[model samples]
Target: MAKQAKAKLDRKGLGSLGLEKLIDILLDEAAANKALKARLQTALAGEMGPDEMARLIDKRLDAIDQSTARINKARARDMAVEFSALARNILSELGAVDPQAGAERILRFLGLRFPISARLVADSARLWKVFDDTETAAQELIQSVDAEEQVLLVPHLERLRLRDRYGEHTGFLLGLTSVLAAPGAHAWRDALMAVLADEPMKFGALDLAQRLSLRLADIDAFLSLEKRKPENRRDTLTVAALLAEAGRFDQALEWVRERPRGMRLIPVNGSLTSVGPEYGAHERRMLEAEILERLKRREDAQELRWREFSETLNPEVLKLYLSKLDDFAEFEEMDRAFAIAAEHEDIYLALDFFISWPRLDLAARLVERHNHDWEGRYYDDLAPAAEALSAKEPRAAVLLYRALVEDILRRGIGMAYPQAGRYVGELARLMPELPDGHGLSTHAAFLAELRRNHSKKYGFWSSVPGGMQG
Candidate 1:
């Protein structure tokens, strides 16, 4: 093996070289020695001027070619961490000197080197903070970069926007709006429109675009672009929302009306009736109701909402409609709705309504009345109802708990053993609380029945708590 020559460059000696030459020397040294590479980055950060620091940063960033920056999980992650910090330091230094220019450089770098360096910068809090900080200069950055260059940044910008709650970054949104508003910003528009045209549209992107359109008061432009593309259920819904928000109630009504009507199959005797449209009609109708209210026809809106709620039993729509009413009217109507819910053929909906209303008493009645036909998910509704009813009505509660336990054991659902055993423990506790002459079986009798029928289920037996293990 050939011996490599000793690399010697004094810390003081680095000052003799030009900024570019110093970067070259550092890159050469760091490439040879990983520890020195790591050391020089921090040591030079404080030692160098902002311009020199930017030069160092730019050199380092450029040097991270496909060969150097290629993701290797086997390599220590500390390298990526170090590089990310360097990128942030460079950006901040550049930003301090020239916020607009720095933002342009950052966007350009992100656009050009995203694929290779995305993982390197992924989750870099400092870089994201720089992005957040420079948001105010976002428009200047957009204008500085060419249309093609700005196109490269669309994805990163979108990512930054989506990272925020409701994509509300003011500066980042300004840049997006500029691109969307620009006559030549087709690449930007296409990127957003592509997301909209996705089989399942990207809700975040759609929301950001809508917000931008709203800011620009460009609903017609957005609708025009959407019309050029294939129709989607989500698009229709979005257009309806945008139009409604713009106080274009007549236009909003048209979008809602355009939705395939009656898409939901009406359940007639436990089977779906084929005559109606069903997939997304409920939401469309809800939008129509909202448009009615916006159009100053409050009575029409209320009646439409009430009819939809009665027909579909949609909790969300009901909640929206109720929110507009006074508390007294809301509760009174809720009481009326509660009565109607009890008779719903979909007993689960009735059960859900009672539970949501937190009317445990009414829920118990419904469960007891329809116990035989109750084919609801055990863990979801049954177990929860059992726990709720246990405090007030031990006999009724026992029936629900026993039903859950039996169902689990009958199905031999091993995953549910721990839960079933806990239910058994609840039954054990509740047995002592039973009133005299309660019609339900005693705890001992119930345990005997469980043992006789499910003695082979070792999974259930082993999970029974210490005292309850009969």
Candidate 2:
């Protein structure tokens, strides 16, 4: 039977045989001879057809990609060294199949680490060494790795930036900048410049690029590249903002003023009757205000910001206005601002602003007017406000303190115990001075409520000195 099979097999060429049949024959032969099995594996590694190698490599890469939990910097350097060998071997096989696609796949793997891989790269300088070694290996596999790889590898730059910012190691950031700025590294430089152009020059890139000996001209040139693109040109405000950040205030204002304006008709009594400059009017005005501030045109800046603040009661705008003036003047300004905040339809914002300002007189009045609105939030603000008012307005202060103590016990929040306990002690001291007809619960009744509701809170009991718990 073996002879007949052999004779029939001999009638057909090995290439003509079905792949499964050929594999079965090889397996049978290999099972009978260990040496042949080893030889077959070696041949598959070296002499396997491109299609077969690609399929095996794709399967292997899929496994590596799926087993993401194992990839991180905390792994020993030896492990990274081993993986470098494995990645190189895989890429070498892949390159034989299709160099460009193999390069893309490899770049993609490094490009998107998914989750904590960037963390891994960022956490240690040793891992950066591994990364450098891997880069060298990748270059060997992909002769002349292209500009796209630089784009793909940008997260490394970001990680380095973070490390540099947080004062991890100066050498690493400087070394990286130097390497990226090295001769024949135009792609790296361009990729970095492109990524950074989207971010503010003041925030990061300006200093880092300058560290690498990159001038403002190079940065401006890169920035203009994005501006030249049709899609990016639509957002002229961004370029204007960048120019402002670069201290070209006049140019920035010019760009801001030059934004294309379109006229739009307003609905008046359901008929289109009014025409106004529509596109970017609000944005342009805001930019102009910011530019005027930068130019030290304080009056113009204040006018624009105050107008916006009056219409919106935006606390940030108010803060910006206040920062330019003295602290003594801020209270007066805050009084005016808080009056507007009080009128705002959102009572929560009013309450929050009053309490945060510790405008206790205003807050006490607000709380008294809307006592039922208290739902146990903002005790941090309320507790302190109550304490501040205790000196002169013990009646109002007692009301707030009692409210805070009740809210704390009702909600079972523990962190407020120390502050609440201290306030309770102060309330006990103020009991003698509190007038009878002050319209607040009696000190005896407040003590009864506290013991009734929170007898079990030993932390609170311990914080309050004597028999006040009764």
Candidate 3:
């Protein structure tokens, strides 16, 4: 006899239960769950009409706004759940019948952001995401309304914009660019310009106006606004990228060649470190190469790409350069690229390039040649490289494993003793297959050396089976 398959409990399967049964189940569950009860009541209110549904939602919103409860971490989770449910009801129930009313309600719900955020002791990411998602939904609802209706809602949008105390909804106006009629957009832009004129240092209005201009494909306006700010290397790169995207290759080339202003300080290892003016130099060069390509200067582009590859051992750039060559020329260029990588100053980068290129033989040789430069602390890289070479280049694998084991013991990282023991086991297994003059001592000699240096580390010795007798 065959076994029977279990029935799935999806909507179709649940529909097998009669309507009365489903209603009874819902009512029983709603009795115990307050959130469910509120949702059911909202759904019931919707059956009457849109007005009644709006009134019920407004009642809940008013209650939420009137509450002065200080929400700590424990309460935040519950608040997120409750608010998310409320937002769903507003969007689904009220939104389905009357989008304009729904848009208004969503805006009101969004307006609670400032006061609600102020009452929280800790920042609740989930709670904040609820508002963020609701803002997007509100924008969609507002767009669904007719043009005249949207025009009427402009004041309401302005109110919500003013309520954005934390600048969380900076893109609110920009998001409505497609929905706003000519007059509404003009009015909003004028309003933003007025704020900018009054407060020259206010970046928020400037950012909004520039983004709006871009959305409208008004590049001239964007550049005019960009020129109002202080010139910096980062902003220059941004403007160059914008120009390149707009197919203005000549202007982009000129911007990319502009001299960098000064050294920029960035966080490194929890400390501020000053980088040279050559920051973003590689990106600038790559952009210039692309622009040159667009200008029908193929040789200049190829030359720039080759220089970048030779300096950084960047395999992508090398591949891009070689791709533009004739069919039979690729083999010779590949040989040249390999030679350049072999002599590159950064050994690790060269190794990475060879590995990515899948020329494992060259990778193994590079490892063997730069044996002394392999630092065990970089196990994140060396360990994987060793594994990749373990099959055909067991000698290189042995070298990397030995470095990892020595570093662990030397640092007295007792937490890694088990891992060290495993490496020791791997070394013991690979020893018999090693060729003569592998530059590493025999397995037994290596074990003896370990015992002499790390004899005091009993924990490590204990982790190895047979107490290192192998």
Point out the worst 10-residue segment of candidate 2 by lDDT: 264-273
CA displacement after TM-score superposition, residue 46 of candidate 2 (Å): 37
TM-score of 1: 0.65
lDDT per residue for candidate 2 within 351-428, as digits (tens), equals 556665556677667667766655546765566666677785676666676777678767777887776677778778
Each model's number of backbone clashes? 5, 0, 0
The numbered model that scores best in TM-score is: 3
lDDT of 3 by residue, 1-470 (tens): 99997788999878989799999999999887667877898899988999999999999989988999999998888888888888888888789898888888888898898889889999999999999898788787877877566656666676777787656765565577656655555566666767786654433566666666766677788788877765441355656778999999898888787757787443233223466777778888888888899989999998999999999888888888888888899999999999998998888888888888978899989988988788777877777887788888889888888888899899999998998888888888777778887778898898888998999898899887568574
* CA lDDT of every candidate: 0.64, 0.59, 0.80
Full candidate order by TM-score, most accurate first: 3, 1, 2
Q: In angstroms, give how far residue 35 of model 3 lies from its true place.
A: 6.8
Clashes of 3: 0
lDDT of 1 by residue, 183-301 (tens): 32544555666667552333345544544555456777678755654343235665787888888889889877876444333223322234444555677788898789878898899
Error of 3 at 124 (Å): 5.5
RMSD of 1: 10.4
Identify the runs in model 1 with alpha carbons over 4 angstroms from their true place.
1-82, 112-212, 260-284, 311-336, 465-469
